[model samples]
Target: MIDNTIFNDKKVAFHTLGCKLNFAETSAIGKQLTDEGFAKVKTGEQADICIINTCSVTDTADHKCRQAINRLNRQHPDAIMIVTGCYAQLKPEEVAAIDGVDLVLGANEKFNVLEYIQKLDGTEKSEIHRSEIKRVREFKPSCSRDDRTRYFLKVQDGCDYFCTYCTIPYARGRSRNATIPETVAMAMQAVEAGAKEIVLSGVNIGDFGKSTGESFFDLVKALDTIPADVRFRISSIEPNLLTDEIITYISTSHRFMPHFHIPLQSGTNEVLQLMKRKYNRELFAHKVELIKSLLPHAFIGVDVIVGVRGETDELFEQSCRFIDSLDISQLHVFTYSERAGTKMLDIEYTVSLNERKRRSNVLHSLSEKKTKAFYQNQVGNTYPVLWESRHNGEFMVGFSSNYVKVERQYDKKLVNTIQIVTLGEWNDDKSALIGV
Candidate 1:
């Protein structure tokens, strides 16, 4: 049996990889440990425990996990190294094979890391316990810590869609959503704790209602009942699942922000079909048009992949043209990186590094233009902004309802409070809004 006494007043460090969801979960875990008397320490410092939250989205991500583990071992050779998250969930054996990893906890067991560590405290052999993710029931609650205005509330978990290029379905299992009442309770708790805005996050937020028979629209309506002070933002959603009813509801809701991020892997029908995406370019464009027609000043973000297999120069140009024509506020450009177990790895088309970089730069340049134009249009408009902590020489910053970044003079009283501000000048150098 392991000893729990070793954890008293112990210091621990956490290293997280991948998505905002992972960051929020890590913060939650840190808070739990802190409440249990564990002190948070900086990475590379001497600590009793080191937790590495791994990601498996790309092969590079796996390499980064190994590197972090090695570096931590070098810094504190005697510390207990714990590996968790997507990479560890999918490949616990790989994580366990590392010389210094004392424990490996999979998806279902990650939340119980402290308990497992207590049990393993003086044990000679490390343990690897990973339950299959498909059997998990409870949704984990995650939110950003203090010192930030916007908190990420993960109301849903897992993905049922097995896209050819995605290993998330395997790592996260089927879709599981938190109960409507539980979600609202947590959201209210966050608001009471000084979170001015909450971003509803998950693996596939569009698939939130599959398990509960309630819809994503229902979640929005429930959140609409929240007192008028706090704003709610939706994270990424699939174009196919973003329905007209949801759009209409958001258009009429006061609490819901007019910012939407829809993933469009490819703009060409053939490329989208090869990628196993559910919707075609026409459907994606129609959604954009519908959102624009309803909320003209809404900030719309699009996700695009540059170097997927079977994407020729002509197809890439077509994708670029299609995005260029959209009324989107910005673009999130992701260069396709093949993962080991994904079906896309077996495909034949090869894109040169130069080509990938070239395509990515093209989209990024267009994104800058689009974002600047959007910000320019917001000049003279009034918006409710949730002021965040001061950064970059201590200038206070926040995000407007349309997702525009606004910067102003620091005020201790304004932190984490949503207040109406008139958009004044555009700081072209900083790519931010100057509010008055």
Candidate 2:
């Protein structure tokens, strides 16, 4: 039997590499460790245990994970190393083969991490406890307390829509979520903890009510009723699932911010069909139009994947043109990468790496132009900016309700406070709106 004295006065340091959902999970893991009599190591401080929560969305993410493991191995070789999250869930054997991983856990196993760690003996071989993704059905609700200004509440988990170029469903399992009452309680807890904003994150948040009988709209509506000054934002939702009711409710709700991030993988119907995306170009365009019509000052962001399988030059041009015609504030362009066991790998044609980068550049340039125009349009408007704790040399930055980046002279009292400020002319060189 392992001795429990090993954990006495232990310190743990955590590093996460991925999306907001990953951050929420990592924060939850940190809370678990802290509650178990472990101290959280401050920045630049060494610890007895190191946890690396990893991502596996693309080949780049996997490469970065390996590099991180090697770097951490050098920094804390003797520290009890734990690797978990999407990358570990999908490839536990591969992660266990890393140089310093002592324990590797999957989606279902991560929450039970303390139990698994107590049984480990600091051997060369990694003790992996990853269950199959198909078997992970229960939703273990998590909320990030890493920052006092904002909270990432994971109201939903997993995805059922196995997109052709995606491995999320395989890494995170099927769609599941907490009941409405449970979600409201979580939000209230965050508010009680002094959070100014709450960002809802999930693998497929629009499919929230699949396992539970609660809809996304119902959950948000209940959240709006919570007696807190915190605002709400949806990280990203599928175009098909962003119903008109949700849009209308957000427009009327005082607590819901005027921002929507909807994923429109491709404007070409053929490419979208190959990606197994439910919404077509027309549907996506209609959704954007509806948001613009209802909330004129709303910030509409689109997520687009360029150079997917079978994306010829003609189709790419069509996509560019389609995006250019939309009234979006910005675009998140992702260059497609081949993932093993994904439907895209078995597809007939493949876009070259050079072609993918070229397409990505084109979309990035377009996004810049759209963002500049959006900022310019808001020059004379007044917005309530939620200032964060981050600061440059002389200026502190914040984001408005519609996701506009605003900057002002550094002031200690302004951090974490929402102040109504009028936007002045854009400073093109800095790419920020001047706050008056």
Candidate 3:
């Protein structure tokens, strides 16, 4: 281990890309460096170390990772540049070939970064430490607070579902997680750090119990026993795994908020089969219907991919119709891009890039309309809102229990505090409701 004194006063800057899970892992890395006596780099100050956590969800994501690496290297010319996460794991050689990267750590080696840093001797080429992702079995628990009051807790890591259109299982490894007690402990730590809301994030959170003998339901029940005033929200879960029992439990629980994020990917069964997804459109609709029936005011966010190799024009139109029929609160639309070394290439059909963009825009408009309706329905109803530390223009913003974005005039006292406020009409742009 490196001596604490040697690391003292060493400032480190972190750049995290992709999911909330990545951010939580970056926070964990920051805490590790802090414990070794490193300070975060302040603005206008050069860092002794620059760590970039990369993503490979899309080709665009990979390009952004490279851009971030180049940008950070330019920003900190002399810093020890470390690159880790999905992009690093999937393309270690490519990442190492980048001009100024000092070290590349894969999924298994990312958390052991301190050991690698101690031996960093400015070698001519970037040092790479990557294990085959399939061999990765250790689950490193992590949690991170956003600028706001919500803290994202990574209850699970990796994925086993290798949907043909996705590279997540390859980049992240098989689905695994820490024990329920350990996850509950991490959540308690976040609460102690003054977290009012904690979100459970992961690659396949519904597949959480694979490593341990416990179930996701068991984990939730244990979390509910915390007896804190904090609320919990589950990140995107597989529709097949989001059972009726779990929905019923959350609908009645005071600790769990009325919010759900489910990935539908494609709404057409033929496209879903081509994508090798576990469930079909009927199952997806059932999950949505169940959530709405149990919790009418819940905020239901759905993930959809606009184009894939097998999605034909008819399939896409069918997808749009099915998605439009759903009573979801919003849609997180992602335009598809081909990735290397995936089963998706076996399929022949392809959506044009222009068509992909048009489809994404169509879904975005639908999302806005649904979100507006959801927000409009909340007007005149008082809900507990956890105000954040930041402000947007003249208004301070907060999210209601059901994830309604509410804005009120900036008040210092409201920061990091919970208050019940009735939602007012939307602003001129319809971005958010004015709260009182």
Candidate 4:
């Protein structure tokens, strides 16, 4: 029988792993618990329930999930353990097999966890329930209201493209998008709930319009129509989906931030072909150049994989040169990690760990230099920063129309407000922009 007495005044802790979408969902789930009279507690403390939102992007993710469960079991052995998210969706059997896990809810059924737990308490037995994502209607809500300043609105989900090196297509099933009216309503709701900025996120944001007759452009147009005091930004888009028209539209929209993060897995055409990326280096360069031409101070972040199967020193150098030759503001370098059931895992001639580390370091060093240079260029420019809560001893801060981190002295009033601040010289070797 479900034990309603256990959660009468109990506390809950959530540990989230993965992308912005996962964090948004976690916040939503936490809100649900809080609304039901359960108290939200910090991690590492003893609690009545522990929810772990997992990722399956890389093999390291799997290892970390297992390690986290083991640690949680040691700390709070008696607490109910719940596992959900991509890892849970992909490998429910493996997760349910873990000794301390009390429940495993897959992607489609995870949102209804409270009811499941209620029933579980009545039965006193662990439960496993996962519905295939393909047959579902994207059950979760589209808006996020937990954050005071920024909200991640999931405008799209799942992916149809089966990139040779990706497992998202299998884990998430197929491409799906929220209707234009529904997405705009959520954006407006977030704005009403004190959100100063909205970030549109998804698996493949560029393919947002394929399922519906609406395009990303249409979504942006509708969002722009919302008379909100908040700005908007996109998470990541494929080179092919990031068309010139979209770039031009963002350039003119007052609410759209001048930032774009496009994933360029590899710079060399041969490596890109092997990775099954749709666009080559030349087309990727054009997209960056077009964005820059439209908005000079725009922050163009590129996602590059350092070491994939069959990567040579020459190929690595080519990748580095391509990035060096771009007008991008920064780089998000990822060392390729093999994922189970992905085509790249079965590819012959894998690079050694040391080689991968070396390439990763090289790209990281270059990224630092590029980032510092970008900050240096903004020295005299004044931008609007949306200040966040305090970090270590300093106040957590955000960037302007273009994404640049600027830190200032602590101010409680600026927590969720956008203020105009001038960028000063680099403060430390950390390359953080000091605000004046």
Runs of candidate 1 with Cα error greater than 4 angstroms are 1-6, 42-45, 121-126
- Weakest lDDT window of 10 consecutive positions for candidate 4: 139-148
lDDT of each: 0.86, 0.89, 0.92, 0.83
lDDT of 1 by residue, 41-71 (tens): 8644588889999898877788999999898
- Writing each residue's lDDT as its tens digit, candidate 2 over 1-436 gives 4354656689888889999899998888878777777898877777888889999999899999989988987887678889998999989999999888999999999987788888887567889998988888889888995443678999889988889899999999999998988888988888888889999999899888788877888888888888878999998999889999899889898899999999998989989999988889999999999999999989999999998888989999999999999999999998899888988877888889898999999999999999889888999999999998878768888889998999888898998899999999865565789898
The candidate with the higher lDDT, 2 or 3, is 3
Q: Candidate 2: where is the Cα deviation over 4 Å?
A: 1-6, 146-148
Note each model's CA RMSD in angstroms: 2.2, 1.6, 1.0, 2.4
Question: TM-scores of the models, in the given order?
Answer: 0.94, 0.97, 0.98, 0.93
Ranking by TM-score: 3, 2, 1, 4
Q: Candidate 4, residues 53-103: lDDT per residue as tens digits?
A: 999888888888888877777777878899999999888889888878989
**Stretches of candidate 4 exceeding 4 Å from the true structure:** 1-7, 42-45, 121-126, 137-139, 145-148, 391-396
Give per-residue CA lDDT, model 3, range 70-162, as digits (tens): 999999999999999999999999999998999999999999888899988867789999999989999999999986778999999988888
